[model samples]
Target: AQQQENSEKVAKAQGEQFQSLTQIASGQADIAKLQNQYSSYNIRNGMYTIVAAQSGQVVKAQKAGIGEFVKEGDMIAEIVPDDVKYAVEMFVRPLDLPLLANGQKVRFMFDGFPAIVFSGWPDVSSGTFGGEIVAIESNVSVNGKFRVLVQEDKDDRRWPRQLKIGAGAQGISLLKDVPMWYELWRNVNGFPPDYYQPASGQKNSKTSK
Candidate 1:
């Protein structure tokens, strides 16, 4: 009986040792996995590389100076892609909003190219380029101006190839075709040319009896 008890104790000790070894092996494997995951993050010369999500030209950089500390989710830079198309943004007077519409032709006279003068009438080509009104913001700005977006008009690709972004430009959009008399009357009365007509089912509350 004494010999059997001693043998049993030895077996138990061996089992416990095996369990401890298994646990250690498991911990080592976990550590190796964590190290591999951390290795995937590009760290060179003790500096981590922050890659941009999309490749583009860096238009503006914030906190780019050396030794500048940046937190996660901080905006590091603003990039404008080379291939991305651009549109002209103009602020229009609130009173002039009624005369503008999407798809209307816009005459653009870039400040950079002052020699050119764009005209909405005559459909003639000059140093000036043509654009189409693509969008008009409904909300007025704090300064009582409305934002307008004008894109390059189709079949009228006379825009300068190397135009700088945010270049100041003046634009004028053509209104719908109207008789000369009506235009003169509107101008005389300081009334905005009407481009929108009420729907058949809707009535102007001010005009309705």
Candidate 2:
């Protein structure tokens, strides 16, 4: 009986040792987990300042200046990512829209550059780039055609391919509505094919008779 009692005591002591070791290991694991979580929190807090991803001119400014109240998701500025190609967006009348399509040739003339065509000169020049109508926005209405976004090739390498309108530089010089008004005004005045041209030559001679 004494021998059996001793065996029972040994078994109990072994179980107690195992439980103590398990508790110690579990406590260490919890400490490591807490430390990891604390480190991640600090890293996230350090990244709070919003910064521009790339260097470029800002093209649009929704809200800016000190003491301005900005709501969540408010557009502060637009950054034209570096090395990106750009295109001028000119809205054509709905009637003229049908004449244009994807893959059709386009001749671009910028006000900044006076030249009508690009002569492959090393210097920046105003001229047409090799481009096609990649897309057409179809929200046509009484206000005229909707916005059309165009992508230009960036091979020129004169200025950064993309330009942000409102950052570090001035915003888009003229509002887009101006062009819409011009197109509408021209339509009212009967422009291009819509203009009535008086018959000349033989027709006028016959009319005199």
Candidate 3:
């Protein structure tokens, strides 16, 4: 009888141990769930806040003002970095499109600045900044011209910091090295030298061969 009583006590102790282990496991699971909820809450809170991904100045702010409804993927602001790399874009006519390609050096004369450009040779050009063609749009732009993107040449002098966004720029892309007399002949005899400046002031890019 004593042995039987001892056996019952051992069984009872085992049952209590099992209950404690089960409770510990359940508590751990609850802790894990709570931790996940906290992380999700943090993520949801971040979505409501306007945070800049990088260190830059906000040039333009939310157009809708404060406490306005905005859907996802909407442009809230435009940021400009302290050391900004400006991109200059120009459009080329269909006839001139054959001359331009990627990696060609371009000479630029910013609208706000004065430059005495020789067009073909950039070395003798004063007050002109150097750039290179980066992108040529496969499709025609809204202006009915092929859009070309120009980036600053890292080896050349940096552009002026005071330059504003959407600033006008005149780009001369030297397509081929041809005789000066030939260029004059082409211009004189109704042969278009790649670009024609219309009075509407829409197209400003010129290419020379």
Candidate 4:
């Protein structure tokens, strides 16, 4: 009878040991869950957005006012992504459109600032990205200048009218900001020639007979 009593005592001690281990494992799982919750709290604390991807003339959106509420994905302001080399676009008429091709080069001069007789697209790290000739409505404008879009780099997106002033000159002449090498090559050769005069507003008007 004493031996049986001792056996019961041993069984009771083993049961208590198993219960203690189970409690320890449960406590460890709780700790893991709390740690995950703490990480999520840190994520909520750090969140922001850049004002604009590129810098240029910035304009406030029409809805933008002091303390105005903005819905998600609503534009807060406008940014002209003028970081890419500027390209002057001109719409060529149907007859003139055929004259233009992927690699057909042209000479361009700025009416306001004409110091440089710029030609062709700017020298890109990628070998001369091609020009795109886009088609628009024929009867849109009274004076037919069909949309002939040409860009050095392909990052060109349509912005507001005022932002694309020099680039929007009409007629067959397209003033594009081409690669640096192309301009230099044109200069070395006699392509643009000496026809271009600097638009410094320094010409003597009185000297003309």
Candidate 5:
């Protein structure tokens, strides 16, 4: 009887040891599964890779540096795309506002390409190309100057490939198709041309002699 009791106790102890080892093995597998899930989530969230929406050369870097901290939606850099088209913006003096109009001819000589000068009348000048006035800002700038947009004259000549964007340029636009004497007279008298007409419902006020 004593031998039979000892055998029963030993069997019970062995069963408890096996149960404890099984629980430990299950816990380890659960931990490994959680680690794999976390790694997959990190990859999907782009924690290791960053890609730009469009391909372009970075002109200015705002926050892209090693060991730098950046939040979501923060601007990393300024990129000028390769396919971007260039337009010239010229600031016109307030005094010259009356002489400007859309569709007028414009000539440009960029500082980068100083050897070339674009003129409205190519027959009278060398190295002259062509452009047209596209828009004129209604409001004046802080410096009392108005902005004008000039586009390349596709019908006349194409813009040079060597010309760079954001380059400073000296632009001369042709005034209204009036006589030279009239332009000179207006300049001497300090009179603004009738470029802007009164509204349809408004009447022109004139002092009777």
Candidate 6:
């Protein structure tokens, strides 16, 4: 009887020890979970002035000046890499939107630079450089115009190295190549040049795949 009683006491002690250890382990897990949630909140809200993932020069800062109200999620800065390729952005008339397609060749005449541009004769263009339509934003911009992105043409002259961002450039998307004499005759006859129309089964510029 004494041996049985001793064994019962031992089993009860072991059960109590197991219960205590389980409670301790559960408490530690709760602490770890809380710590992880705190860390995640700090990262999402940015504990410090946001750190850039890559090293580069900040060309512009969009922060408000001193004494100005700062808003959450406002841009902190604009960083440009050391070796950046530039592209010109131009807004197109809504009526001309249908004529532009992906990879369509364009001619550019930069403002503040002199260039005698012949729309139909891009090959003989003097100061004008070549580009191609890379992107077209259907969303309307200022004055109800659509935005188009143009990049350097690999087959033609390169853009001027001195050109800076925000510089204005007039662009013309060339379509439907024709004989030079036919263009001149059309101009002389006061005929408006024909716009490009894709035939059946051709990709639509507005919805080009």
What is every candidate's alpha-carbon RMSD to the true fold?
A: 5.8, 13.7, 9.2, 16.6, 7.9, 7.4
- Tens digits of per-residue lDDT for model 6 on 1-209? 99999999999999999999999999999999999999999896785465787877888988747645567877878987666677888888887787677677777889888998665566777788788777899799977999888889999988888787788898776667778898889989987566554234776567556
Cα lDDT tens digits for candidate 1, 1-209: 99999999999999999999999999999999989777755355345566776778888988767888888888988888767677999899976777777877777778767644434353554567789778999999888899999888876866888787988887755556789898899999988666543234665677656
Whose lDDT is higher: candidate 1's or candidate 4's?
Answer: 1
Answer with 5 or 6, whichever has the higher lDDT: 6
Clashes of each: 0, 8, 0, 7, 0, 0
lDDT of 3 by residue, 95-196 (tens): 888777777787788987988867566577799888878889999989999999999988888888878878999887655556889888987898755532
lDDT by candidate, in order shown: 0.77, 0.55, 0.82, 0.52, 0.76, 0.80
How well does candidate 2 match the true structure, expressed as C-alpha RMSD? Answer: 13.7
**Residue-wise C-alpha lDDT for candidate 2, range 95-180, written one tens digit per residue:** 66655555344444444444443333313444434334567787875577654444453443243333343212111111122365
lDDT of 5 by residue, 1-209 (tens): 99999999999999999999999999999999999999899887886566777887888889866878889889988888788767799888888777777777766666755444333344565555577777899999887899898888877768788877677777765434567788789989988764422125667899999
Clashing pairs in 6: none
TM-score-best of 2 and 4? 2
Evaluation by TM-score, superior candidate among 4 and 6: 6
TM-score of each: 0.68, 0.46, 0.61, 0.45, 0.62, 0.56
TM-score result, candidate 1: 0.68
Better of 1 and 3 by TM-score: 1
For candidate 1, the lDDT comes to: 0.77
TM-score, candidate 2, is 0.46
Question: Which stretches of candidate 4 lie above 4 Å from their native place?
Answer: 49-85, 115-146, 151-209
lDDT rank, highest first? 3, 6, 1, 5, 2, 4
> Top model by TM-score, which number?
1
